[model samples]
Target chain A: MKFDDLKKLHQKKYRQQFGHFLVEGEHLVLELQRALTRGTLASGSVTLYVSERYANFASPFEKVLLNDRQMSQLSDTKSPQGIVALVPLPEAPTTIQPAGKAIYLWQVQDPGNLGTILRTLAWFGGFRCLLSPGSVDPYNPKVVRASMGAIFHVPLELDVPLAALPDRFARIGCLDLHGESVVADNFVAQDCFVFGNEAQGVPREALSAMGASAFTIAGQGAIESLNLASAVNICAYEIQRAQG
Target chain B: MKFDDLKKLHQKKYRQQFGHFLVEGEHLVLELQRALTRGTLASGSVTLYVSERYANFASPFEKVLLNDRQMSQLSDTKSPQGIVALVPLPEAPTTIQPAGKAIYLWQVQDPGNLGTILRTLAWFGGFRCLLSPGSVDPYNPKVVRASMGAIFHVPLELDVPLAALPDRFARIGCLDLHGESVVADNFVAQDCFVFGNEAQGVPREALSAMGASAFTIAGQGAIESLNLASAVNICAYEIQRAQG
Candidate 1:
């Protein structure tokens, strides 16, 4: 790939056109290498870019050297970490549903929230993140950065439709006010969990149509809502605890 | 107060010197009004600033109209909400710990993380936020905005010391990798919970000296750590669930 293309990877449409995304910083690059070694990512699908400071970082992947100025240009953060990886987007396994409970996010907008939620899901394990059609792109640089490298570990399915969830998961659940307590026994039994936008929660008509069960995280009604990431974090933790 | 003084409230030193903080946006201004009416905030300690659009907004507090440029000048967000409130900082009670379990944050720095954590604390209610000396100022503009008005609902004690924790709470708890599970019954009976910084967790020396009980949120350990706000959120939910 041309050096010009690496800069373009910072933008979403260009990333889509090239079918690769930029993973900057030593932490994410290390994770990319580890994932490739673990066979989670294909061996030859990554190209590592490094400044002279990181040129000697040992790895099996092909290396491209960028002068400090070039590295800074390709980096998104104010303080460039001197290393970046261009890795192929993971292909969805269309023939199979992933072997875990599904977490469906309906049009979550905040990049930090999406990234943090992905980290939470990966930490708890046994879960695949399914993003609704209007959701923020998982490969967007901010999401990738905020995931703190969990973007590589957690399985993600893009453009997953909220309307299609009913046909897919027999038992879908969401958090709401007048719902079963998350501590309740059956709250742990859902095959999939759905969360809504930060401002607009899963709507009433959609909830009724999907026949989705509702669950509650008990709180003192002082504040109207929890941060979207916090809500998902609590749900993911609750699911993990109930199962364990 | 002068317009110059109000603009300076964006900085921590100015906020402290003037003994007031900026709460921007319509949601926060309404929350300030609600809080004042509920007598949670003392009467006569607030001044509302609004653009022409919000000049007619209902409020018991004193209101000042600023031209759009002035409103924009006082606003921190890219898109100003045309309403701002100058609220007196909530004074901490010297004689007693507030009536709730304390959530002691040790040097948390991120404005968004602190705000989101405050929302979590408020949503769970029955919890007081204790910020260690070096933590981000709760009154920072970004914290105020990100909190979505929960900053008004959550009781906060600032500049609380880590070393003073033992003298304050009888049984302090913190999350650690090798510890009793958060689902354990004993985790429910804590007087306070201590969470550490984003990068550096509660130091071993401090944890040992405080004799803080350790609790774990079970995870598959694919990621090294959960986001600090997410960790606190999960803990708060677990505590609420166990108690309820």
Candidate 2:
């Protein structure tokens, strides 16, 4: 791809037009290399771009040497880290199975929130992330940076509608104010744990459908809600504890 | 204070000089009102600023009417929310008496991370937050905005030195990779839970001093580490669960 085309990867339209996304910084580039070594990512799928300063950094993949100006143009952050990688967007599975633990986000609009949730999910492993329509683009530059390389590790499915969830997952769980306590011994493993938007929460119809499965994290304080990522992290931890 | 002086509240130096901070958006202003009602915050301390459109919104405290341009000048966000509050900075206690649950952050540089941690601490309630020297200013505009009003609810102590901690608390807990699992039945309450920087874990000297008290959150994946705020949230939740 030309440098002009590479710059287009910063926008979702261009990323979609050419099934590729940009991963910036040394840490993420190293993670991408590790992913390739682990076979989670295909070999020769990453094209690395480095400035003169990082030209000597060892890599088995194709390397494109770029001047300082080119490196700055390709970076999404101020003070470019002098290195970036163009990797093919991971393809989503056509069918999501209902067997293992998974997270489904519905209309979550914040890129940082989605990125943090992905990081948490990646840390816990064994979970896939499904995004309902209207959620932020997981491939957005801010999301990828905030994810701290988790984007390359976690399996993701995008643009999955809420109506399609019931057909794929036998058990669906969500958080609600008056729901059962998450710490209760009765807390069971659901095939999918659903979270809603930052302000709106899970849709009313979806909550009603999942009625008894809604759970709350009991607390002694007056805080109205937890940050979306924090809620997901706590829940994911609890699920892992239950399995143990 | 003049509008020019109010604009200065966006910076930590100005906030300290004037002993005030800015809270943006309607949700946070409403929370401030609630805090006044609950006696958690002083009743007359908040000065609300709203554009002509939000002039009709009810507020218990002093309200200043500003035009669109003035509102934009006072806001930190790209799109102004039109409503803001100049709140007196909460005074920190000179001496921290660590009698119950508390969180201590050391050299945490991100305002968003600090704010999210404050939100989690407030949700659990009955906990105090102590910032070791070099941590992000808790009163920064970005921290206040990301905190989602928890800034008004949680008690905070700033510029505390690590050396002072041992004199105040008998037990201190921290997260470590090789420490005991947090889910272990032997997990006990510590007067303070200490978290370090985003990229760097707790300082080696501090960890060595509190060696036996360190704990780890067991996970199934290959993630190197959890986000600092997420780690704090999980630990706080586990502490609350243990107490119950």
Candidate 3:
């Protein structure tokens, strides 16, 4: 396709109807291409649409071709990496099945924190993530950027009502300052991990109703609690290790 | 001081000439005030400047008041919390001490990461931070925000050349992917912890010539290492635990 045609995709109108967003950068483009080639996509197929004028773009993907100006318009970055891809948003996984190894977030408001935590989950394998109704939309642009493509690998289910969580995944743990030590040997492997709000933490009513136990990641000195992103990383890693 | 006068301090020129910047918010304002009351500063010092209209801005600190407009100009935040202070810049700390425990960063570019690490250090307790030359300026606004008030509590010294570091901090452990397991039982507590750039990690020159022993924070994950902030938290916690 011509370069100018790709540039037009940046508008919200085009992005919505087409169900695709321009993802730039050679590394990410190649990764998406690999996923496509491997048939790992959750739903609609991604097309390697490119223009010949932009052929010099140094991406790892086998397929690529786009004109320079065309790819540049699709990029959100200040310095375009000379490549862009039109990727279908992965279909949200259905039949979560409460794998007895999952993460639940309650109203995690910061996009950056949400994305960072999502990336952390992808790093430490095992564990699906479910976002309660109040949580920010996972597909928000800031979350997508901070996640650094981890959203593609991690199975994140959003807009899930808290009441819908199943009982077999019963080992729900919440992080609270008053909770037990996270590092204790008694830490058990469970399916459900619930994180609360950024400022107020999980609502008291939600905590009470969930009947979830609480545990704190211990630190000796001055911090109130780890930042939400940091807390998630610590919890996710420890939980992954404990289960393994 | 009237509110109009207080508003002028947010500008870089005013901050430099006055040698003070507004550190507002309930937590930060309280922390600075506490330090002042403890006689941490010289007598007749802390100008607990706030707009007189903001007299309702309650704090334990004795107010040498300013007006609303002045407070707004001095604040970096979009909405001034109605309190601002014109405290003196802290005297540069005395000679950099390598007193058996230290945190070092080499080309750690992100201000948020630098500030967050400083906060983590404060939380872990008993450690001094040293930033290699070319690292992010310690006082960047984003760094200040992410560090919360830990920036005040943690002593961060920057501009030290990396090459000269080992001469003072002899026992330096470089955090690397290929190094020995940092979480293993055999891991020993070291006098200094060195982390490299986030993208490139520690440069080979520093790793080889400085004679810093290598250690890896164990993560069998997708990405190479934890986020810079998360890695710092884990390291600080590990150090404190090892000491205990």
Q: Per-prediction count of colliding residue pairs?
A: 0, 0, 19
What is the alpha-carbon lDDT of model 3 when measured against the actual structure?
A: 0.67
TM-score of chain A of each: 0.96, 0.95, 0.80
Model 1 lDDT at residue A58: 92
For B99-192, candidate 1 gives per-residue lDDT tens digits of: 8788899999999999999899888988778999999998888898788888888888889888998997899898877689889998989989
Worst 10 residues of 2 chain B by lDDT: B91-100
i-RMS, each model, one decimal? 0.9, 1.4, 2.4
What are the per-residue Cα lDDT tens digits for candidate 2 across A61-157?
7888999999999999889999999999987765547345878888888888888888888888877888988889999989988888888888888
TM-score of each: 0.97, 0.95, 0.84
What residue runs in model 1 are displaced by over 4 Å at the alpha carbon? none
Better of 2 and 3 by lDDT: 2
Q: By DockQ thresholds, what CAPRI class is model 2? A: medium
Order the candidates by DockQ, highest first. Answer: 1, 2, 3
- Model 1: what is its DockQ? 0.86
Candidate 2, after superposition: displacement of residue A110 in Å? Answer: 1.1
Task: Please state the error at residue A108 of candidate 2 in Å.
Answer: 1.5
Which residue window of length 10 is worst by lDDT in model 1 chain B? Answer: B36-45
For each candidate, the DockQ is: 0.86, 0.74, 0.43
Pairs of residues at least 3 apart in sequence or in different chains that clash in candidate 1: none
Note the Cα lDDT for every prediction shown. Answer: 0.87, 0.84, 0.67
